[model samples]
Target: MNQLEALKRWTTVVADTGDFQQMEQFRPQDATTNPSLILKAVQKPEYAPLLQQVVAQGKGAEISALMDQLIVRFGCEILTKVPGRVSTEVDARLSFDAAATVARAQRIVALYRAQGVDTASRVLIKVAATWEGIQAAGQLEREGIHTNLTLLFSRCQAIACGDAGVQLISPFVGRIYDWYKKQAGAGWDEAAMAGDNDPGVQSVRSIFDYYKHFGIRTEVMGASFRNVGQILALAGCDLLTIAPDLLAQLQAASGDVPHKLNAAAAQGMALERVHYDEAGFRFALNADAMATEKLAEGIRAFVADAVKLEQLMQAAAV
Candidate 1:
């Protein structure tokens, strides 16, 4: 079997893209979309019709509502391809507003439902892993709206997500790797940090170990992988949302994809259970410079793309 085939035996591979056309070939069990990805897709000539259709239908509705509809449209298309689920992210601008985040998430779910989607099973409302976001997810979960907490970069975030009883948590792998590598500058040793020693890989591993040890029911889906190595290192995660290029590389490569992360082994380790309240969560997140910076940077990047997407919609409306 090719590496992708081998990896699937242990992990549920998810396509991390707004371009649903790319998903059929990879046969990802699930798919994930963010504002940036949606923005990227709508800009393509082939996807132009999708944007125009949404704009034409939305008419004079608020841009925010139209944005939600567009993403839900993408999610609905993605769902037709993947059998399991599709994560549609909330607007990153509401990352810190629990009430607004919850309201927006409910609206997104309502849009999906209007299209006959089984929101509880076939959709995951993706939210940033802010304390407020987690709290918002907890509220959504209570209402039977499953959530995928995204932009998570710390164990504290993971812990909080688990506490929130979220359906899943996407701890970014590549972004963490990027931050550490950039910080190391000249002292970075690629050879030593390539595989198991990779900081990003280690971060997911630590979160995985903790979740397994505590029997946390929230699934961990490692996202934002930079290369095949990071994906391979996390072969046994609950799920790994990978870009199409890396998925293609794995599909082309021939090798044994090892089950690198073992739940039983994680459970065997001596790990203390950790929980975080609002203040504690804030303090913990603030203490981790990498997590703090990346979380903010990720939110800003997504918000910028969301704005760009709105601009495209406005132009299409005219």
Candidate 2:
């Protein structure tokens, strides 16, 4: 079996793309999407009609209604290709507002439900990993809504997500590496390519170990990968959400994909579970340069995509 197949033995591989057309080949058990991905997908020629069609179908509807319809349309299509859940994000512009985030998340889930998508268990409402976001997720979870915490970077973020009893948390590996690499300049080395040495993998491992150590039920999904090496390093992660292109790379390789991260091994490790209040979460996140930088960057990028989506909606409103 190729590494992709091998990795599946120990990890739940999730396709991390907005393009549902690309998911059938990798056969990820689950799929994830963000505003960035939806923006990218609607720009493609093959997917442009999805944009036009959704807008056209909603011609007489409100812009907000049309936007929600378009997002669920993508999620609805993606659900047909993958056997597992599809993550549809809430508006990042509401990341700081707990009640607004919760309302948007409910709206998104309600949209999916209206399509008869069986969203109750198969949908993951993606939210930014802000304190407000986490609190919103907690409330949603009580209402039988599962959440995938996005834009996560710091360990405090992970702890908060788990404490809130979120269904899952996606700790972005590549984005974390990007901040430190740019900040470190020539200090970043390529030789430390796998295992604990990989910044992204290490971040996931840290989160994973903490969760497993405390028997936290929330899942850890490693996201925003820079390469297959980072994915391989987290071979036994709870889940690794990869773009279609990286999934293809893993499918082509025949390396011995050993289980690098095991829960039993993690439980035996020295790392203890941490409990972070709002102040502690902020202080810890502020202290971590990479986490602070990437969290801001992730939110800005999502806001930009949200704006582009609005423009698309406005043009269609005409």
Candidate 3:
């Protein structure tokens, strides 16, 4: 079997893209989208019509409303191709505002519901893994709105999301790799940290082991992978949201994709459960320079793309 097929034996493969047309070939169980992906998709020739359609449908509505509508439109298209769920991210600008995050998530869910999609089962509101975002996710979870906590970069972030009883947490793999590699620079040994030893892969492994050790019910989905090796390392993660490029690589490659992670192995490993209250969570996140820098950078990047998306919508409205 190809690596992609081998992966399906141990993991639920999720296509991480806003390009719904590209998702059908891989046949991923779920799909994820962020402002960056959506912005990229809307600019594509095939997806330009989708943006124009949402703009046309919401003529005089607020730009933000139309933005939400566009997200749902892409999500609705994705839902038809995937059997599981579609993670629609909340605006990154509201990442630190608990109330605003909750409100936006609710509105996004409502938009999905209005499109006749089963919001409860098929939609996951993607929120950044900030303290406020986690708190907001907890609130949404209580109301039966499932959330996927994204931008997660640390064990503390994962623990807090688990505590929030979120449906899933997306621990970014590639971004962590990028930060460490840039820091190491000339000192970095590519071969030494190639696969399971990779910092990014290790980050997800640590989070996965901790979650399994504590019996945390929140699913762990490794995200933002830079290569197929990282995905292979976390072969038994609850889910892995792979970009279309990486998914294609996996589909074409034939190999024995071993189960590198499993609850049974994780439970037996030596790991301690860490609890993080709000203040503790903040301090923990603050102490990790890599996580702090990357989290802030990730939010800023998303916010910038969101603005660019708005510009595109504005032009389309005219």
Candidate 4:
């Protein structure tokens, strides 16, 4: 079996893209999209019409409303291709507003329902891992709206999300590696940090071991892979959301992709359970410089793309 096929035996491979056309090629079980990916997709020739159609149909409605429609439209389209579920992210600007995040998540779920989607089973509202976002996800979960907590960096964030009883948490792998590598500057040894020694890989492994040790029900889905090595290092994570480019590379490569992270292995690990209240959560996140900077940077980047998407919708409206 190819590496992709080999990995699937242990992990549920998810396509991390807004371009549904690319998903069929990898045959990922589920798909994920953020404002950035959706923005990138709608700018393409094939997807440009999707934006135009939403603009024309949402006449006089608020632009934000139309923006939600556009994302749900993409989610609906993606659902038709993937069998499991699709993660539609909330507006990143609301990452710190629990009320607004909850409101937006509700609307996104409502819109998916209007599309005849089995919202309860097929949709995961992706929220940032901020304290407010985690609280918002807890609220949504109580209402039977499953959530995927994205932009997760620190173990504290994962602990809080698990406490919130979220359906899943996406701890970014590439961004963490990027931060450490840049911090190391000239002293960074690429080969030494490539595989199991990779900081990013180690981050996910730590979370996985903790979750399994404590029997935290929230699923750990590793996201934002920088290289195939990172993905391979996390072979048995609950799921790994990978970009199409890396997915293609995995599909082509032939090798022994071992089960690197499994419950059995994690159970054998000596890990202490951690619970983070709001104050504790904030302090823990603040203490980690990498997590603090990357979390804020990720929110800003997503918010910028969300604004750009709105601008595109406004232009299409005219």
Q: Note each model's CA RMSD in angstroms.
A: 0.6, 1.3, 0.8, 0.7
lDDT of 4: 0.94
Candidate 2: clashing pairs of residues: none
Tens-place lDDT digits, model 3, residues 75-149: 999898999999999999999899999999999998888788888899999999999999999999999999999
Query: What is each predicted model's overall lDDT from 0 to 1?
Result: 0.94, 0.89, 0.93, 0.94
TM-score of 1: 0.99
What would the per-residue lDDT of candidate 2 be over residues 1-318, giving only the tens digit for each residue?
899999999999999999999889888999999888998898889997788888888888877678788989999999999899999999888999999999998889888888887877799999999889999999999999999999999889999999999999999999887877787788777776444687778888888989998899999999999888888888888999999889999999997898888899877888755788889988888998888888888899899988998797778567
TM-score, every prediction: 0.99, 0.96, 0.99, 0.99
Q: Number of clashing residue pairs in every model?
A: 0, 0, 0, 0
Instruction: Summarize candidate 4's per-residue lDDT along 42-62 as a digit string, tens digits.
Output: 989999888888989899999
Per-residue lDDT of model 1, residues 217-278, tens digit only: 98999999999999999999999999999999999999899899999999889988888889
- Candidate 4 runs further than 4 Å off: none
> Which residue pairs does candidate 4 place in steric collision?
none
Where does the lowest 10-residue lDDT sum fall in candidate 4?
265-274
